[model samples]
Target: MKKKAMASFLIGYTLLFTGSVYWHGQQFSQPIASDAGQLLPTAVKSIEQAEGEKQLQEMVRRANRTGDKLSIAGMQHSQGGHTYYPGGTIIDMKKYNKILQFDPKRQTITVQAGATWDDIQRRINPYGLSVKVMQSQNIFTIGGALSVNVHGRDIHYGSLIDTVESFRLLTAAGEIINVSREENKELFPLVIGGYGLFGIILDVTFSLAKDELYETHTRVIDYSQYSSYFQNAVNSSQVKMHLARISVAPDTFLREMYVTDWTNAKDEHKLTAYNQLKEDRIIAAPKLLLGLSRYSDWGKDKFWELQRTYMKKGNGKLETRNNVMRSETAFMEYESSSRTEVLQEYFVPVSEFADYIDDLRNVLENEKDFNLLNITVRYVGKDEQAVLSYAKVDMFALVLLINQGRSSKDMKQTEEVIRKMIDITLQHNGSYYLPYYSYPTKDQFDTAYPHSKEFFRMKRKYDPDERFMNFFYREYGQ
Candidate 1:
């Protein structure tokens, strides 16, 4: 929560919006402000809102009165907190979380922007319908998911945007627009992956399907023989959910494949409330169980504590559909190094999934300088959020997670690999998702995202004064 470090980042905005008397070293109609010189930590103030349009107006008025750069985020799970733009106000939608309507016949529910995936599940569970994708850990707010275009359970459902039926978005110019496929069709897909560039998402009403159990299955497949195997899994009818999780080693790449099938959700064997005090769900199943541990905004320590508790109940070996469990936390750890810690992840086009994995395996096997941990490949449905939607390639996505320390020399090594990865991705018209931004150069992003120019054009229309922007976007570089 330290606000002292960003005195320099603040200068960029101070200089960018310096034309008018109303500016005063701050943005016009922005709710985030600070003392001249030092950047302040943007904290989430609930503003004690009621459930209606009045609350929305009051919130917008506050942003204008404050006159600092302001942006609205739902769960705030986005890494680096929207680093593309500098100091801006963040309107956290977590407080406005409530289910506005549920149309059972239509198999859809409308919830407040701040409602988490888990929140929606509980609200509609009694009706026997469930969200299709269930993106990531189920803790992400609806608005945040759309902002980032979250995807989950590979080979099953597409990105969360695929399930979105409609949404109410507040444009930068302070206009509320209700968008959907058959309704406001053009604006529909554009806003889902729109990355909050065009507007602030207020509420989302998406479609859902009847709840079904998943018969869990898992196997250890060698990395050398992954491409064809993965292609088959994606197209397979029996394999509803397929995931590629890689473990890095010197000689061999250990890839774990998780495949699941549909079962009866109403079956009594499904998860029931357990007597355990620390954890909520437990699986009473066979050995060789495959459980899921996804990421959540809650503190990493608190999340892992829950995971450990869940693990203690049953072995990680064999698990059944009714017995499978899920925890909200990614298992990425920093390797012990002498200097600083830095992270870099690059996405490769699905068409070249084979080559990307081959090149990475060659490096990790031959080179000792790189200490690799996670190498995940998943699927994404394309959208227009960022100019470079990794979803453009309707195939496999290979991620190389690198941990380079914060030293000058280590950075050089990291940059070299990153540049190469970006080159490989762009060679086949692929783009990286929002994990590590610096890896892809501005030129690379423009190439991957041909329509990105339109995103900037729309930004000017809404945030005409360039008030809602990030460091990456402000520089006109990727």
Candidate 2:
């Protein structure tokens, strides 16, 4: 009888696993929604044509006259409804991509708002130049990154706003004006991290960094010592780009961390050898492994071991700056109708790192609903450039990727965990990132961003009609 019961259990598990794989395969073949199926249907959505400025201006003017809300969007990677309004018009900018100017001598590149980092790297890589600061993935558009003011693996740099030289903005009034530190100065900071509530970012001019070969280094360290370790070695040293991952597997669960540092190779021969940008070829295997980890403890333990081993094996490998910027993202994609992955980032001062980690571990371990896939740690220097800057002081950013179901109960549970996490973040003098879902309440948003009222006030002042609008404003601007 015991043997019969065991056999039945094994057979049931096998069937369930097979069904899941089959369903995933069917979903994966089609277009995946990055908004995690939360996007509300808009009344009008039009792709921005390559016909240029006149067409865009006309469209904006038409919207203003018609009193239709206008929401500008790039890659639309923002999980929050930062790119949409209930019945508003979406001006899709992906097709408007074009590299307008490239001056190798000036170490600067000017590109249309719709152009992505991938496009910029392709244009600048051969010249031995690279983007100064951007997210780890090169798939995001330049304008989107600017709007979010994304920071990256570059420990030496601040956020994306630091590298920006200037840009042209099409205000709600249908007037195009140049904005920068020296010109239209107030709008400079607001629009960088403004979440498209200000105007349409037409084009951008940002500084570039030299593309150099880097020698990779990896080390496992205790969570408590990370703050000190970063200060002494990674932050103050010659490291060019640095990123660390805190183990979220059942065994480690934020107690253990592994850091990867990239420093100048200093050898011209190695530079040429590794100058070519890389593309992920073995995505299927890793994707399977990652998918397995999302469901079971056994899978999580194995995946954690594999991740550490992969990092260890890459130690001392040489890679170019441009190649490192375009890390593999295809394998991390999930295309399920019932489940999806979401990101939440918190920025805490360096002094509060260990305490915050302890609090984070406690909250996550006690939470029964949310499945945290991974946490990647990166250093963000003091950034006062943006009006709604997340990093007020030199800080450490904890980027958490979590898996949650699509059901209403699942969303409520996820919200509870997120709210608890935000409370912890606030306690540690940290600020939560605004690009993710709207789990935090209006009060939480106000507490985290002290300038919330002022930001909204400025928005109304610039465009009283609220011509430039998004769900972000709808939630917090009131």
Candidate 3:
């Protein structure tokens, strides 16, 4: 019996891993483009590689000459059509990546826009330095993160905009200009979260932080108690990084929650003991488990139970900051022609968290085909540095991952639920993230982002010809 069970497990693992490899490794045919969401496949004029600044400038000039709109693409992780436009040229920046400068004394690094956080981590990990603010996954490019002005688990920082020192931009007219807080200050805020409508970000200089060791802590509590718990225990303590997961399992379903906090290690000497950067490992098993959670309620309950057990076992583990930033994403890879996983984030003022969660619970419970998979919560300090900033106040961001079919009916159902969620967000004085599909009405967007008119106006002022464009601009700018 034991041998048969072991054989069955091995066979399942092999099939799952093989499927993942095949899906992730497939290549697309020419003139076809899509973002990571795989929801909107577009036919484009051409896709071009960006080799250097001069080459990029020439490409932009040629696009303007030919009346072809240009869109910038990095790792293309955005669920929205932010990276491509129909009949437009895509400037692929992945190969233009290179570290331009690093100042060890000041703890600053400048790199080409195409450089991924992973590239920067490998270079600076040896010097005991790390990125101050970035997304949870390292596969995303710096340009893409800056365009979105992303945030992560760090409690000490505000958002990615706070750490950016300077960057060079290639405007629509093929002019390269240096932009920073001190010089070209007006354009500074407009471009960070401008969603590639401004221009192509060439290279960026960012402030860095010293690498430190952290001791992990985890606790399970009622969903209502989370806001108060974070305020009193996590924020007022030595916790440097924190995030929480509200249960999506059928049994718990927004009632049970677990918080993970990383505080300074009790032993400073342990920093060196675990300072080496860690890479993702043993992903196939987790991928299999996530697949189970995506399809069945029983699988979700078991997955939740296993997740709690995993977090419990990880309590008090010591890890370096770089290793923590290198969060595993391989296990979440999903590829299906008929179905896909989509992410939508909502941010509510800290005071409105419980109320917002209550409404969210009601909505999810009533919608049977919603296929809500996971919800991870992170805190963002009040930051208005970016013109399109999402965190107007000290807010709790709920990142929701849902599985949906590809049919028109499925999309309509998904959009309806999303609009309902957005309406709830507005009622709670909150905002939804713009990196996803354009499900919210124009009125909802204007209400959430009052300064969006100014942002779009500036986009036209900077590029009157509309040489730089994407589906995001088409959805909101016009």
Which one wins on lDDT? 3
Off by over 4 Å in 2: 1-51
Record all residue pairs in model 2 with backbone atoms less than 3 Å apart, i.e. clashing: none
Residue range 1-478, candidate 1, lDDT tens digits: 1243133223321232111011223443333322111122233222133255566655555666675555555544454335223445455567778899999889999988888877777776666566776554666778768876767654555677778878887765556788877776666666666666656778888888765455444445555556666566545546545555555432234333322323233443443332111223323221001111111112222333343344344322332221222332322211222322233445554556666666655545555566454455566545444333557646565554444454667767766776776676666556666533354667776776677787677667556755555544654422
- Assess candidate 3 and give its TM-score to the true structure: 0.94
Error of 2 at 92 (Å): 0.2
Model 3, 1-478: lDDT tens per residue? 2565345434543442211010222364447877767778887778888998899999988888899999999988777889889888898898889999999899999999999999999999888898999999898889999999999999879989999999999999999999999988998999998888889999999999999999999989998898899899988999999989989999999999989999999897778779888887656556776777766787788888877878878999998999888888767766654677789999999988888889988997999989998899999999998999899999999999998887889999999999999999999999989988887889999999999999999999999999988988998888
**10 residues in a row with least lDDT, candidate 1:** 286-295
Preferred candidate (TM-score higher): 1 or 3: 3
Which scores higher on TM-score, 2 or 3? 3
lDDT of 2 by residue, 378-462 (tens): 9999988788989989999999988887687888899999999999999999998998888899989988899878889999999
Question: Candidate order by lDDT, highest to lowest?
Answer: 3, 2, 1
* Candidates in descending TM-score order: 3, 2, 1
Q: Which pairs of residues have clashing backbones in candidate 3?
A: none
